[model samples]
Target: MRFARAIALGAVTAVTGGLLAAVPAAAQATGAPAASAAATVSVTLTGKAVRADGRAVDEVGVFVVPAARWVDEDAAPVSTALVADNGRYSVTASVAAGSSLYVRVDDWTSSDGYMDRLFVGKGGKAAFTYVGLAPIAAKAGTIELGTATAPKLSTVRVTTSAPVHCAKLLRKNGTLAAMECDYTVDKKVFTFTGMYPGEYTVGAMWSSWTDARATVDVSAKKGVTTAAMLTLESPTTMTGVVQDTQGKALEGIAVWANGPDSPRTVTDATGRYAFKGLTAGSYVVDYSGASGMSSAYRDYVTRTSTVSVTSGRVTTAGSTLTKGAQVTGSVTPLAKETYGTIVALAADGHVLASDSYWSSDGKKRDFALHGLPTGTHTVVVQDAASGRYAKSTVVVSGTSARTVGALKPAAAPVTVRGTVEGTTAGFVSLRYGTSPLYRGAIDGGDVKPDGSYAITHVVPGIYALRSHRTTSTAGYEGNLLSVTVGDGVAVRRIPQPTRKVQTLQTLVRTSVTFDGRALPGVVPLPRRTPADLWGNWTNEKGVGQAPWTGRAWDAVVLEDVFFAYHSPYYFVVKSPTSVTKPGDLANVTVARVAGGPTV
Candidate 1:
């Protein structure tokens, strides 16, 4: 109970400091004595640290940070000892009667650091009362010692019934932790444990690697005795035949079992290939060459069908390696370049995964490229020889390919022009739309002084125009406009939509109160004036009423009664001698005051 009180006080200090200062004292009063009389408690703490493979971690630091306040005030150690070379650690501490205890184990230097609380006593009925590096307990049951045996270490042996060399192994950490564990080369298996109970991810490394996760839980009664067994059995084999476009066997052509972890296999002279040791999942079969030739082979050969690998089942995936058209072209500026290197770029602007070649010609200017996929590609003729060059897009089809004309130097100047509206003075932004987009500033033209602007020397192609407002102006308007231009095309401006404004009106009212004692001549109530009162008002009797209705007793009396009743009526006074007539009130003009339904 004293320990509990101390913990409560510590929690309070951790939160709203000093808010619960009185709670600890009150708690101690209700619980057992703060210190027991003439009793000494002995406690022992111990644990082990090891690699995932269960090998004891040697010379590791394992200590505890005390959580309780020392009753003696001066009985606290600054530090504790390191564990033995065999990964075992122990600490003993004595406590006075009624003292509380808590223990923590951790390492600060290792990549895999850990911190945990150690429970003492059978039911974990002890509490932390004093601050110290060694474990402490109030009773003899406060600390219990145990050993952490390293789990058995083993490698996973994967073998496909068929020939496959590209299988992968993935661990619970979500990484292709191991490449193809070819049973033929690395027959050793891998095993890991000493992990707390939980779900873990286990899968193959390649695209075909099946995602198989396992769960482990260790019970308290089991202590450090827990084990898990995982057996990764190979799925069915997929057999296939690969041939060239001419129907000849394509020997050494690599075939891949694709999915999550795509594995690869090589075809035999008989044009036959097999992917073994696969799981039950969708897989793609690809035909290519070994590492270096993969890019070119990928360009020429493609997958034919997806095969399903099931347990003890066989799937067939026959495919052909087409002989794609081979293209050959020569670079003209190889000799005059400094690095004397030429690079070929694909239509998508990606550098071909091929090596750069130097022109063998004496001119040091002529370079040739062969075995290119039949398509349109940009032939970049850099001055590898002269260190200066130009690029031109060329189309390649048949086995023979060549440039039709000499490469010309790139034009340095291009024109940019556009129409602007609503803007008086601000810069327009010009940028290229495609890859390697060029960004530059353009000055506003004199067209509308505040409107359309134009800039010169903009490279030909589609360009984006953005308007920027000056600091003094409000802000830019409209979205970016795209403009296209041909070589030597005139500057042109696309029209921008004009901005418009809308107006609205609503009738608002005001209230006015008048006391008969404050103004004798004024009406004591509200009324509605004739719609044409500003111009003129005529009575049915043909009498012309004054526009102001000034200080008129009849007018006031009539208006007050009309507003009070909210209806047309003949004026009548409470006096019994008073007489009211229609014509008498007709000459009295009334006007509507501000508030709704004045009465």
Candidate 2:
């Protein structure tokens, strides 16, 4: 008990800078008596946040962190809640009974900024000292911590001597904390509001060149504004002209400077193109134009040249265009599948040209690529729904148009099945490893309460199985398991054996509704907020049920966006209206919060 007391005190003091004044020293030290793991409890921390001047915060972000991870730089909130305009918040998170935890409160409202922008500290990292209390035991019911004081938010404004096309604010640790590009065109200034008082670096740029940088400290007082000025250095410029091999100026040719800012312009009447306000650097200038030979077809000329630009001086890079080749092809998609992008890739893996196809379009499934340099290219076509793709190699010689005939059909996609042992609180995904065919990880569905998972529409190949914790914002930790799928395997269960995941026998039948209308495609995120997703966002009707876990509250359901930005409507299940025991119906209704973000 004394060891527990010491660890609790050290952890809390390290986070809060002091002890909670409301709780007695003996109570803080003793905490709640240790309970067996089977006796894990759902604890609710209720509290209010006040500003330095003792005024109640309009809305505050309340978070609970386990003491074990309080010092971990990437620690995530075990549970999160938002205080109402009334300054009161109640958030629930499941923890082992007798576990010591920390409660944090900050001046982060959804209206002003994002959760990551809460408060900036030492290295431009989110500071956690605004309002914190810790070492509280995980009791079965609500625990009230008295009002905690937090600092007032601050604002900073930056002005530049010259017009800055872009600017960024850096944290003390040189991290690109923010680029609150709220630029005032007339004043050549940038405004950053609702920032935690601290030292920050401001860097301004014209085009892609760094003009100047300045450091300033934001005042800690409420409504006090910090201001800083940045002076510019001499500017750089890059100019170019384009003409055909016949010495004829190619007016209206597209000219591009591929460098820092990638400025682009079209050749004027004199075939001249200029890019001012550039950074001092080397640039590759590209010129492209088409010569009218006949109404049936036009020969396209494309050329490139490299030039170096110096500060306060104009550098010229000109190019004489030569006819380039074109690549044309047709694609045939699999039955019931739509065509995705058809890309012509060079041997170096750079995409030369790309176009899309649709099954619904009346035109033939034909694609064409113009202005391609004479080279060998791999023409690839992928199915939109399925990641299956086909590729064909073609060669273009001396401005001659090369044709790739109808591409062969891609191999059929396969399904993968696996079991995630130990915990039912996370999802399993199949990530492509060194597979040029697939682009990203295929959603393997959420690990069911029984720990079994099946992922469909996966391209047959070697893949890495990634386990993502449902309660943490930190995405896919590492490849926990590897899976190799072969063609013609309809449904192959991974060699990994299925293991039982412990669960609280309590089954809660729940139905979610928004504004009295039953909402479909809502995910049941047990004990966590909408910010932490379980990733099993398949279509489940409003009336769904799940077994409660030992390490979770009743449930928190959010509208499933299914790989897209989510809707703002969500609800927390405190208790059922009628039956409260195992295998009972838990009917819940969620109303949209007034003035909250809408879908």
User: Which lDDT tens digits does candidate 1 get at residues 350-431?
Assistant: 3332224443443333444444456776654443323244556667664445552555333444456555655565556664
Task: Tell me the lDDT of model 2 at 491.
Answer: 42
Candidate 2 segments whose C-alpha is farther than 4 A from its true place: 1-47, 50-64, 71-109, 112-145, 148-152, 181-187, 206-222, 239-254, 257-284, 289-308, 316-599
lDDT per residue (tens digit) for residues 237-343 in model 2: 67666776787776777776665556766776667766667767877765656322221222454565777898788787777876668888887867544667776
lDDT of each: 0.37, 0.51
For each candidate in turn, the TM-score is 0.34, 0.39
lDDT of 1: 0.37
What lDDT score is found at residue 599 in candidate 2?
Answer: 6
